[model samples]
Target chain A: MNLDLRLDTSGDFYARKFQPTKREDTLILNMGPQHPSTHGVLRIILEIDGEYILRAEPVLGYIHRMHEKMAEVMSYPQYLPNPARTDYLHGLAWNWAHVAAVERLMGLEVPERAEYIRVITCELNRITSHLLWWGAYLLDLGAFTPIMYAFDDRERIQDILQRITGSRLTYCYYRFGGVSNDIDDRFIEETRKQCSRMKPRFKMFKDLVTDNFILRKRVEEIGEIPADTCRKYGATGPVLRGSGVPYDVRRAEPYSVYDRFDFNIPSYDTCDAMGRYLVRMDEMQESIKIIEQALDTLPEGDYIMPKAPKKPKPPAGDVYFALEGARGKIGFHLVSDGDKSPYRLKLRAPGFSNLSLFSEVSEGVLIADAVSILGSLDLVIP
Target chain B: MSEENAKPEKAPDKEKEVKKKEEPQVPKYTGYDYDCFLAPQELLKAVTKLDHADFFLEDVSCVDMQEGFQVVYHFDRFSQPGRVVLRVMISRENPEIPSIYDIFPGAAWHERECFDFFGVRFTGHPNLIPLLLDPEHQGPPPLLKEETALKDLNQLYPDRVHTPVSPDSEEFVKEINNCSNQKSRNQS
Candidate 1:
């Protein structure tokens, strides 16, 4: 066997193609398809003049699995587990979006109890997602101890979710008309216990990290994205809320039992990295509130619809369903041709939109602040 | 630069704008509040109307239908939440459409994804290279349906009307403007 292992000194295809301006002083740098702070396989090509970045372009598709193509070939039920893989941190939201889109198209009615369960589990999942982000983001900024505290809470939620969903991450718990498994009395008791425990932990987190002078200086006013820029780029979730839009998909477009819950959409007008940090921190508390409310108002009924189709063949038409995932708005656009499988399914990953604005926001900021801005975005590159 | 030159140019443009009014079909079955079909040329104008109306672009997606390539653009507002889907049908032989990148800026990646999947050319896109596929891969676009598997617009849409609305029409402008004010499906 002949092995041609000659090193290409010029650069890879993406690097060579990402031509810098005709300036002798500027240098092109690749941040990572492997860099630690990126948190996943995200490569950012940057043109920097000394420490300040002149231009930044994110090169994607390193981990593209073509889930859309998978949906085309698979049946409705067969495609259930695919959405969860897109954003593993907030898998239930993606699962909900996929199932809810199909259910809306078929006009299947979900029992009230099922809606409450979805709300509780999904909110719990949201907290875990935020917790992981909080820890990983702080770790990216060179802090390690916060992740320990974050995981303590995260593992508990994962254990609770693992029992019902059968997996800690990338959960496929939601079904067409309802969830796959019903919650028992022990599940409720554990969730209530966790929610109560989380309240004081948040206060500790604030005093320990959020209000710390060093952490505040590192994050505050680092990446200032105006509200108008957020709208222009279609950035959502905390990224948009951090810019002070308060445009949560839950309140803006109510889905499931979100409207029934009384919770505040925490927003900051600072339009900086600290604003985003604070929003996520406050949002975890709101999730606890939502879970507590749902638990108190838990109704009794079937978890999954009795007549739910095993192999759903929705009528010929299309439906668009969106939900508030931890990252942002997770949308599923399903087109049916009166077949067991979707004719064409498109996923609107909110991280894609949120990250798109990075190129614009990262310009003129120092390289370290670029990492801060990226961390503040809390991206889960699927 | 003179008013006289602008007057003659504006006259014929006004005359050409006197096309028949077409009302967008509000199909209650679909989750969209307003669903309209537009000629490829009118996409930018319609998108500009949406931008002025304070609607944010959700995502731009494309579907390969037997009739043509249907490029779908989903938009929603923060203040008043309602989904408005714009469907532009372009010929399969030349699957080209005007890019909304200059207006939304976020459609750049979505258009590239469409190009990578279905080989749809987004004209005026600053960077139209492959976004989520291997740049060196040599094969046909992956998402194109087999000829036998193709379904026409009627088969996919069924009962919905497919009339192409003129972007310059008063009714079209009004519909785009009022789409957000209309109560969302969940609220109704």
Candidate 2:
């Protein structure tokens, strides 16, 4: 026998750091920076004692593209499309957060109609994000049919958005002061039709998935996170709402024309994965209500601000603009020194804060239950 | 121990009142709910006060400038929704501050990310490994201050005046106490 035997000891950074402390009873497992169940490039390190997880740590930066560094080097206009790539699921929200932060710092006034367009498109994009999360989460839990149903509604909404915004996935529709293009009659009419169409699909989703008893057991009471835990770990979106706190960034800190929209922030006090699941299921309906209301009260004016600068050089100051993304509060902390490029552009990715609680939540949970809890978080890792 | 004592209290209506009393006295920064600058040492205390006030830590962001590195912590309330930002300026040479992970457990990853980028160390962070950066990452921190990229702090924050804060100054502690006492009143 070899004096010192190792399982090919020389590996990458993560592999070297991931050795098992107790070789006899404990096993360490790596679960993909390239896995489909992860939704994106998320690698979770799990230390297991038989079937129960003793500890779990997420190792990130596999896909870190240095977007913050890009924001510094790229001019203001050149950096417009970059934010969308950060959270591709709710691209518009990130885009709006960046543009809105710049606009606030510059003191530029957006027209009434432009604000409404921003509201409508952003909400539509949010519905798409939730739909995908719904479909993908179910797929993660061994269900394949619901994704087909979800994509049915998601594609149609994306179709309406594409005709106006000119992109389906990573949208750069929002400009500094307003939207890139005006929403025509066709876009509004088609959006209204889709909103009406999605209402019943949600009912069908409940009957097909939410009502399923097997799904309930997998989620309910599994990975239970109390309201105090959520606050301590700073988890937001449905994760926080599910834990019984009715904190919605839209209602909490009203930004743009969100105050004009009337929609309830759905919350559940169960503090379980099932609670988070229900909160999101109900939120899709609330988003639809917002879209319909905005269309009814859609004021007539230019979608893009008339005096909006082509290459904005905002005055020297720091502005932190946060908006309610489909996942949580998306914030853009912009520090400008009267330059076209941001001196410091810190993207407060909601997923980053929301995902930080995974280690605490996954502790003492079954491996399968941990998977369920991760999906319920609705992560769009940046 | 103020926090642990107040935890078992089940009074919902009075919870807001007590929280408001202990909240910090943050200056009214337009667009933000409350804004205050803290010496590097006060970062942990101010954040702990916010955590006790039921405010969730939003993000831990860093800005590299000519003077030093500015670490920004954004927080918001659930019961009474408001944004509070604590800006702490650390000397560029040392670039370390006391960690708030003991208070807000969520700050763990955020602090690591800041460490990965601007190379700002959180003194008490348990796991300060590379979060969003590969440990094999070469060169200086990706967002390190390049000569051409640096901006004067005064020019960057034209509207807000920077009053240098000594780590053990009485004025800083008093300001934090006032802000901690007035959290609910911050809603306005």
* Model 2: docking quality category: acceptable
| C-alpha RMSD values across all candidates | 10.8, 11.8
lDDT of 2 by residue, B1-188 (tens): 98877767856757875575344322233456556787776666667667666788888999888888888888877776667778888889999899998998898988998999989999988878888887977899989878776887776775575774543566544543344313533554
**Model 1 per-residue lDDT tens digits across residues A1-382:** 7987998668877887786777789988999999999878999999999999989999988899999999999999999999999998999999999999988888788999999999999999999999999999999888999999999999999999998889999899999888899999999999999999999999999999998998988999899999999999999999999999998888877778898999999999999999999999999999999999999999999999998888988877898988899999988999988789999999999999999999999989999999999999988887
Worst 10 residues of 2 chain A by lDDT: A14-23
Residue pairs in clash, model 1: none
Interface RMSD of each: 4.5, 6.3
**Model 2 lDDT per residue over A260-364, tens place:** 988999999999989999998898899899999999999987888888999998777787777889888888888887777988888887788778888888988
TM-score (C-alpha) between model 1 and the true structure: 0.93
Q: How well is candidate 1 docked (DockQ)?
A: 0.33
Give Cα distance to truth, residue A8, candidate 1, Å.
3.6
lDDT of 1: 0.90
**What is the Cα-based TM-score of model 2?**
0.90
Instruction: Report the C-alpha lDDT of model 1 over B1-188, residue by residue, as the tens digit.
Output: 69988999899876764331112222344568888999889999999989998989899998899988999999998877778999999999988898899999988898999999999999999988888899997989999999999999988887678999988899887776677523545455
lDDT of each: 0.90, 0.83
